[model samples]
Target: MARCFDGNKLVIASHNKGKVREIGELLAPFGVETVSAGDLGLPEPIEDGLTFIANAEIKALAAAKAANLPALADDSGLEVDALDGDPGIYSARWAGPKKDFTVGMEKIHALIKDQDNMAANFTCALTLAWPDGHMESFEGKVFGTLTWPLRGDKGFGYDPMFIPNGHAVTFAEMEPADKHAMSHRADAFKQLIAACFGDNQ
Candidate 1:
């Protein structure tokens, strides 16, 4: 059986402003107080894991230990089929020190220039960990294709360059509620809710 989150306050183990905000909103419905790692003066641990799940667990465990509280972490990235998932785990690193997704997107576009297959997808791995080192993890993905000249300015990271499978607009073009409705993170959250929060569980 999966572990459960019985705590009233949870730490969101991430320093990314966009990610922190999105996750805070997601946790609001549960009525749990959410604090961020950045807000708590917690250092971001190195994300050297080979997979999203591993990385999420690393961050979650680090925060849980540091704060002595239950914590949640998400590791998400964009993967292009043509690139053979070239920046998969290194998605954040591709943005460089300044975390500029514009430069990262340009690099991807340049590498796949003249290529027809622009298939891509977003993957998210979420881990919830307790102070005792016990944990539960979940993953989610939203399939989409690459778009050039990127559209919209709402979302952060590679959002503007990705056109989700069923939508004409990129994620950056959609409203926050719209994006959250079908986001990779949301998909993962569903599994998490079922595992950790559901009455049936």
Candidate 2:
């Protein structure tokens, strides 16, 4: 059995405001108070891991130790099949030091414009780590195709151009409630909640 989250306070181990906001919204129902690492002035840990899960764990574990509290960290990115799953873990880096998605999106579009397959998917790996080094991890994926002329500005990152299966609109075009219903993060959260917070529900 996985270890449950027994504490009321949890640290969201991320510096990205958008990611912190989205995660905060998800935890709202449980009445779990969340404080971001950014807010706490916790230094961002180097994500040297090769896989999403590893990266998530690195962040979560670091925060847990630093804060002496349980922490949740999420690592996610886009993978394009035509590009050999490129920019998977480097999704954020592609935007350069400024973390600009527009530049990253444009680079991706340029590379695969002539390719036949625009197949892409968003993958999320969520890790919850306790101060004692105990941890639980889950992964989720939402497949979609890449589109040109980025459509919406509602969502952060590559959401403006990726349309999930069975959806005609891009992620950035959808409302938060709508996107939350079928996002890679949501999928991972389902498993995390089921395993770690089932009794709280």
Candidate 3:
């Protein structure tokens, strides 16, 4: 495993502030300097991939090539068993161009209101790409069920209604630190860090 970022500068391919902040917090301990796509003035890619891994790779590659530095990207969404994993990759668009997750959550809740299985989980795929074309991918998921009447004001996207397995509180109701400790993105990022920086502690 690659060990120690050693003050390496990397690009986080995302324009979302929430995502950028979460990623920055995850990478901070490594002494890595992070920059976002919005910081670099890079245009968001079409993200027309058929899978999360593909989309993550696309964004990572784009950022790596553009910034000539190592880059990381994540593609994540909620997958409902009752909905046939629908709004998987389309999670963002389900809220429309305005990125209003409230509407998306309402839509999802309505669609699954009558279903017996409200089981769902959040999935995250992370891709790291180098300017030389070297790349790696990792994935993680947090199994849980959905909830109605979205709770809490914290977290973004579908967090308000997501109740992880074995937990009674929604992600939106949890602190950022608490959420990061068990989130799908956190799981994937832990694998990424392990892959990039082995057990140095």
Candidate 2 lDDT over residue span 67-147, tens digit each: 999999999999999999989999999988999989999999999999999899999999999989999999999999999
Q: Model 1: runs farther than 4 Å from truth?
A: 199-201
Which candidate wins on TM-score?
A: 2
Winning candidate number (lDDT): 2
Candidate lDDT (C-alpha), each:
0.93, 0.96, 0.89
TM-score rank order: 2, 1, 3
- In the range 1-201, model 1's lDDT, one tens digit per residue, is 998787789999999999999999988888889999999999999988999999999999999999999999999999999999978889988999999989899999999878999999999999999999999999999999999998999999999999999899999999999999999999999899999977533
What is the alpha-carbon lDDT of model 1 when measured against the actual structure?
0.93
Model 2, residue pairs in steric clash: none
Clashes of 1: 0
lDDT of 3 by residue, 85-152 (tens): 98999999998889999999999999999999999999999998888887889999999999998898
Model 3: residues with Cα > 4 Å off, grouped in runs: 1-7, 199-201
Question: Would you list the rank order by lDDT, best first?
Answer: 2, 1, 3
